[model samples]
Target chain A: MTQRWKLTIEYDGRPFVGWQRQDNGLSVQGCLEEAVRRFSGEAATVHAAGRTDAGVHALAMVASLDLEKQCRPDTVRDALNHHLRPHPVSVLSAEPMAEDFHARFSCRGRSYLYRIVNRRAPLALEAGRAWQVSVPLDAEAMQEAAQRLVGRHDFTSFRASLCQAKDPVKTLDRLDVERVGEEIRVTTAARSFLHHQVRNMVGTLKLVGEGKWAADAVTAALEARDRAKAGPTAPADGLYFTGAWY
Target chain B: MTQRWKLTIEYDGRPFVGWQRQDNGLSVQGCLEEAVRRFSGEAATVHAAGRTDAGVHALAMVASLDLEKQCRPDTVRDALNHHLRPHPVSVLSAEPMAEDFHARFSCRGRSYLYRIVNRRAPLALEAGRAWQVSVPLDAEAMQEAAQRLVGRHDFTSFRASLCQAKDPVKTLDRLDVERVGEEIRVTTAARSFLHHQVRNMVGTLKLVGEGKWAADAVTAALEARDRAKAGPTAPADGLYFTGAWY
Candidate 1:
């Protein structure tokens, strides 16, 4: 009998091309699938809650796969981790899932964290982990601007040119920005997202935080519903897929 | 007339070899000194509160140099940051110091923070920023055990063999181990420390937290004054020079 499994994987996105498999480079899913195949001798197809873009990281990314194996959950976790050691991918948890549990299709919500170090100095320990902005930012202004984007809207202005969303309309449940010391964090949650919507929004928010754009500019950008109207897309280095609800 | 200047510098230690200049690679001191020379057309010696090792990071690292240049503090900060940008170093603040001020010799205390991620998850964003421990740790027990090594002692058990401390008898003002979620933080404060002292103490405490060694074992190890008596030294990646007192 085939058993479905749910896995929570964590990875440093620097080494891998991205979460999806590509002919030219390595990917988190490809690593996990290969580990699964090596351990169970079955070619398993893994589905993830979010197919994170290249250079985007994750602390707790959910995935599901099916295999015809009698091994315990611990065995699966250990075997995958062993094989994945050569790669940056790590399997944090493994558990038997109901047949109906689907990693992508069943995921009800997703949350992401964007980190920015606000200081005159460049990042050291947080070099790749955060967006370092030497110029001072008004996080309160960013928060106020973020509140304007926390609702259902056609986010074409925030969508990437290559984003393959069936529709540009998405419901953003939350978009909150807060500052801690010299770091400003942008936390976002939504049931679903249009392609590059979060990053594009963050990029525009940066302009607001830097006092380059007023809060009303954000509302006008949304109303424009054109990608060219938004600010530059933020770098992928600071984006993190923190969790997904199933 | 020459003036003594105190510089509060910040740098990303990843690119440079270390705080001290060496023939093999770039150093933080070399970058700052080079910038001073470029600004004043004269070579300057830069002294830091601590000579950090390669790949080790610091925040609020204090340094001092003598300069005869006629410029405002903000001018020096901006000029150095501009020149040091090519070197990943930044001068956060610059001020006139007492003629007798010495960056290292005048420091009264130094504090360091060691981060340990007590989990099986592979680090993506925090890859080089923290040490990961797969084994479950009893943080409270570790905290209780860390106290055993507090106060003044020879600390030879935790001192590295390569350490150059003339005398192992140093007063430890505080040693604290606490848990913040999945991270176990070990904070140490002392007037000065032998090489690898903090890492060594943390390594020994891990044994107590893992149940491999008891709290009494740490006290015995200190009394033994034997390097082999304590646990292995923790990795340097988790260590951070948090602050220094002048």
Candidate 2:
């Protein structure tokens, strides 16, 4: 007999290739599945709510798996954690779920947080965790300009060239930019996001923050609906998968 | 004639042995001094306001040095940062100071922060940055009990056996513990502290937070004037040098 388990996980993305298994290097998924196999002696497959690119971190990424061993939810969590000691991934929680529940398909919403250290000094403690921009950024201007992107639109200008989405339209529920001390944080949420959508949007907003672009340019780019019309895509280091709403 | 310089530094203390120059391995002080030498070809000595033990971090530690090379403050800051690229230390700022000014003797107050991750799950992102306590801690009770240690007293029970302070009496200006999300942060300020004083106090407070000891027990430990009567010393990973007040 097999049991379905839903899990919430936290990870530091620096050590793995990405959330999915890859041929070239170690992946977060591979580490988790191996831990499960070591703990339960079963070759159960694990699935994630969403896939992330290389060097992108997740705070509360939702995942699901199956097990033939009869064990409590807390026991499953602790045992997996014990086996996963060498990796930078933690099973924060585990719960029994319905047989039909799916981690990727059952999710209703997702949110991301982008961090920028707007200072001239190079980062020491936050290296590999946040992006460092030497120039001073006008956060208030970035906040005002980000509002233009907070609605349903044809986001062709923001989607990656390799995006496999059938449509470029997405309903962006929230796009907020705020300054906390020496850091500028941009947070966004939606039911779903196109490939490289959040990074492209943030890279575009950074131009407005640097006084290189204006609100009019953003509106024009959205209207153009051309991939080449928008700014460059930001680095993967600053983007974090913050949460998922089900 | 050599000129005096005051500097504010930030560092990740994981790689080095400690803040001072050690014979066994690399140190933060040695890195700064070598960076200064490489940048200006001057063999200047870098001095810190407070010496931290192995694996302790700092946000804004104050230091001073003497340089015969003439340069702008910003130039000094950027140039030193450039030379210190490979190390996990950064010079936040550099300022020309009066000849009589000294980082250690002129400091009026010092503040430290101790972080505890109060969760059943192990840490992933905060490894080596915080102390993870698997048992549930009573934050409100801990906060109420922390007030008992805020005043002038002989902290002999909290002093390390290797402490070299001439007197055990010191004025503790502030000691507060608050919970931020899943973390419990304990902040303390004093004119000066005996070796391992902050860690010992935090260790005793952990007993209070765990319900193993009470406020009366804390008072009795203080009045005993013996290190054996107090709780065990906390790990060095949780403590951080927050600031130095002039």
Candidate 3:
């Protein structure tokens, strides 16, 4: 009997090419498939809810896979973990799911967090983990400016040129920007996102954080609906796919 | 003419041997001397309050170094930062100090913070940053037990066998243990500490956190004044020389 399992995975995406398998280099899918093959002799493809990009971290990326073996859920988890020890990948949890469940299609909403360390000194422990900006940032201004981007609208200005979305419209459910200590965090949620949409929005908000742009300017950029009007995309290192809702 | 400057330095101690100069490998002193040579063309020796070990970290380690060059304080800071760009060291602040201000001898008290992650899965991003424990721990119990070791004590039970201190007695001002989420942080303060004393105290507290030993057991172990009575020394990865007061 075929059994489907939903796995909540977490990975430091620095080493992988992305979430999807590619011929050029390693991917999260490749690591999952390799671990799965090591545990079960039969090879199976892994499907993920989010196809994150290179240098993008994940806290709870959801995935589903099928196995022919009738092992216990814990057995599969332990075996995969044992085999995956050599890699930086980890499977946080695994459970049996309905055969009809699709990791990518069934996900209702996804959340992403962008971190920025605002300080004069160079980062030590958080060198690659958080985006380090030497100049001080006004997080309050960024938060107010980000609110202008929170409703259903044509996000063509924020969408990447390489984004393959059918339409430019996206309903941004939440965009909360806050500062904690010396770090600024931007949490965003949406049913789905276009490629580089979050990064572009963050880049636009950087102008606000730096005092060059205001909340009204963000509205103007959205009304313009031109990619050239938007700020440059933020780096991928600070972006994390936090979770996905079913 | 001689000029002395006070330096607040931050470093990721993983790459260097320690906070002091040694013949074997790269040291924080060696890096600072190189940066000084690059700027003033004169070899400088830095005197830090704590001579930390390898793989340890520091947030605001205070140091004092004499410079023969008549450069401004900001120039020294910026030039050192410019030259130390290739290395994982940063000069947070540089100010002229009295000639008698020795970093080690003039220090009042030193503080250290140790971090442990209590979880089943191994660390990915925080691999070298925190100690991971598979077994669950009761941090409140550890905190309560930690109070038993506070104040002045011989601490011979917690001292390393190889410790070369003249006397085992020392005044421990504070030893606080607390938990934040899955992390248990232990902060210890003292006028001075014997070799591996903090790590030893934390190791013993782990027994209390695990329900293996009680709060009174810690007091008993300290009173016994026997090295065999205390727990093993914790790993060096999670240790940090947080700050030093002058």
Q: TM-score (0 to 1) of chain B, per candidate?
A: 0.95, 0.98, 0.96
Question: Per model, how many backbone clashes are there?
Answer: 2, 0, 0
Q: TM-score of model 1 relative to the true fold?
A: 0.92
lDDT tens per residue, model 2, B35-68: 9999999999888888988889999999999999
Model 1 bad stretches (over 4 Å): B9-18, B23-27, B30-42, B68-91
TM-score: the better of candidates 1 and 3: 3
Model 2 chain B poorest 10 in a row by lDDT: B139-148
Per-model DockQ: 0.47, 0.81, 0.52
Which pairs of residues collide in model 2? none
Q: Give a tens-digit lDDT track for model 3, residues B1-246.
A: 889999988888889888778999999888988898999998888899888888888888889999999988878888998898777888888999999999999999999999998977766666677788878999999999999988888989999898888999999999898889889999999988898998899899999989999999999999999999998888878898888887
Model 1 chain A — which ten-residue stretch has the worst lDDT?
A120-129
Structural similarity to truth (TM-score) of each candidate: 0.92, 0.98, 0.95
Chain A TM-score (model 2): 0.97
TM-score top scorer? 2
Pick out the ten consecutive residues of candidate 1 chain B with the lowest summed lDDT: B120-129
Worst 10 residues of 2 chain A by lDDT: A237-246
In candidate 3, how many Å is residue A148 off? 0.6
Report RMSD for candidate 1.
2.4
